[model samples]
Structures are given as structure tokens and as C-alpha cells.
Target: MSTRRFFAVALVVSLLVAGVASYYASSHPDGLEYVAEQTGFIDSAEDSATADSPLADYQTSGVDDARISGGLAGVIGVVVMLVLSTGLFWLVRRRGTDDVDSDDARPEHARQSEA
Candidate 1:
């Protein structure tokens, strides 16, 4: 499949999983939090620096419905990750060239001899 089509399908699947499937997730704390609580150090854990962010605790702020809040947060998270990763890939990606004599494609000794 084409790259664009692949990415389009991936984005749709990611958004659907984030926005719809998240509602079925367990309400209990995740593994780390559960272990912390069992070990009696849960209270000692400090809030993250983003504790006051709108998406804190995987829920959007000021949203009445838990499902909507969590779903919104999940979708937002997926979008942010996709944008950041795509931009990074674009920035670091190799640009193809038709020139065979490019310095990078030449052996070190040949480049030194030319210089």
C-alpha cells in the first residue's frame, strides 16, 4: 500500500482505539499505582509536573461525563504523539539524490584523492 494510505488507516485506527475503546478500560489504578499501593508507598508519590494540565489523570478538565473526558484525552494524546513523531521523522529523514558523485556516496580514499 502507499505510504499515505497506510498512514491514513493507522491514524483512523489510533483515533478509534483512543476515543472508543478507552471507555471500556478498567477504572482501577494501573499496575505501577497498584503495586505502589500494595507496598504502602502510594501516598508518598508526588504529583507529576503536569498534574494541573487539562489532560491530567487521563481525563479532560471540566468534563462531566467520564467516558467523554477520558476519550477526549486519549484522542488528544494520540494526535499529539503522531504530529510530534511525524515532524521528527521528516526532519531527520534522508533526502534522495540522483547524483552518483555525491561526497557521502564516495569512498573516503576517493574523496581525499579528489581534494
Candidate 2:
């Protein structure tokens, strides 16, 4: 398959996995919350004052469908991380190689002195 088709299939597969994860996520407090509750600090957990944030509780602020909300957030997080990692790698990879000519390879000490 073409690169585009491969990416599309990968995305669909990732979303499906995330959807399943959302379906199976625990209703009880997670590790942090459980610790807090057991330690008698659960009351300290205040509502995020940023009520306007789109993702407050790993759920879209106003979304009512639990599965859809979590799945969407998971997908969004994955896509954002993929884009950021790709950009970082591209930047690092583009720093040298075919673009830099052999003639520009001045001695390291000389190059450092110029700066």
C-alpha cells in the first residue's frame, strides 16, 4: 500500500485501540486518586479552576459520551505527539548530510574561533 494509505490505516487502528481502552477504563479512582483517598487527601482535590479548558478530566469539557470523549482525546494526544516527534526528528536530520558541501567543512577550532 502507498504511504498515505498506510498512515490512514495506522490512524484507524490506533483510534480503535484507544476506543477499546476507553470502553475498559476503570470507573474507580486511578492510582493517584486512590492514594489520595486512602491517605485522606482526596478532599484536597479541587475542581480544576480552569473550567474553560477543553480537556479538564481527560474528557472534553462538555461532551456527554464517555467513550467518545476519552477516545477522541487519546487520538488527539497521539496525533499531536506524532507530529511533534516527527518535526523534531526532521529538524535534527536536516541539520547536515546532502545539503552541506564538503568545502564548508572548516577545521573545528577555526569554526569555533569565528563564532
Candidate 3:
């Protein structure tokens, strides 16, 4: 498939998974939190540095409705991830192009001398 089509599908899937499926997820702790509780150290865990952020606990703060808050948080998270990944990929692509251009600009003798 074309890159644009692939990315479009990926974005849609990501949004659906995060915004819709996330609402059905179990509220009970599953991984590390569960382990900590079972081991009797759950209380010792420190709050995340971002604990006070509006979207801290998988839900938007002060949103009133639980479903809406969680869904909005999920959508916002997906958008932020997409933007960051796109920027990182763009930078890497540009860096690769620069490397190729610089290599091409060097004379054959200069290229050989660097080896």
C-alpha cells in the first residue's frame, strides 16, 4: 500500500483502539500495581511526577462524565503520539538525505581516503 494510505489506516486504528476500546478496559490494576499490592508495598509507591496533569490517570480531569473524559484523553494521547513519531521520522529521513548528499559531493579520492 502507499505510505499515505498506510498512515491513514494506522491513525484510524489507533484512534478507534484508544478512544473506543479503552472504555471497556478493566479498572482493576493488572501489572506492576497488582504486584505491588500483592507484595504489600503498594502504599510505598510514589505518585508520578505528572500526577497533577489534567490527563494524569487515563482520564481527563474535571470532565464530569467518566466515558467522555477517558475517551477524550485517549484521543488526545493518540494525536500527541502521532505528532511526535512523525517529527522524529522526518528528522531521521532528513538526516539520512544529508548524509547521502554529503557523501555524493565528496570526490572519489576523498571518499577513499576517509576509509
Q: In terms of lDDT, which candidate is strongest?
A: 3
Evaluated against the true structure, the overall lDDT of model 2 is 0.77
CA shift of 89, model 1, Å: 0.8
Q: Evaluate candidate 1 by giving its C-alpha RMSD to the native, one decimal.
A: 4.2
Query: Pairing residues by index, what is the TM-score of model 3?
Result: 0.85
**What are the lDDT figures for the candidates, one per model?**
0.90, 0.77, 0.95
lDDT of 3: 0.95
Candidate 3 lDDT, 1-115, residue by residue in tens: 9999998999999999899999999999979999999999999989999999999999999999999899999999999988999899999999999999999998999989989
Write the number of the candidate with greater TM-score, choosing between 2 and 3: 3
Which has the better lDDT: candidate 1, or candidate 2?
1
lDDT of 1 by residue, 12-107 (tens): 999999999999988999999999999999999998999999999999999989999999999999999998998887765633343443767888
Give lDDT for model 1. Answer: 0.90
Enumerate residue pairs that collide in model 1.
Answer: none
Q: What lDDT score goes with residue 100 in model 1?
A: 42
**Per-prediction TM-score to the true structure, in the order listed:** 0.77, 0.65, 0.85
1-115 in candidate 2: lDDT tens per residue?
A: 8999998998888877765576687788889998998999898787768756786666765668887788777777777777998899898777755456553676888768878
**Residue 90 deviation, candidate 3, in Å?**
0.6
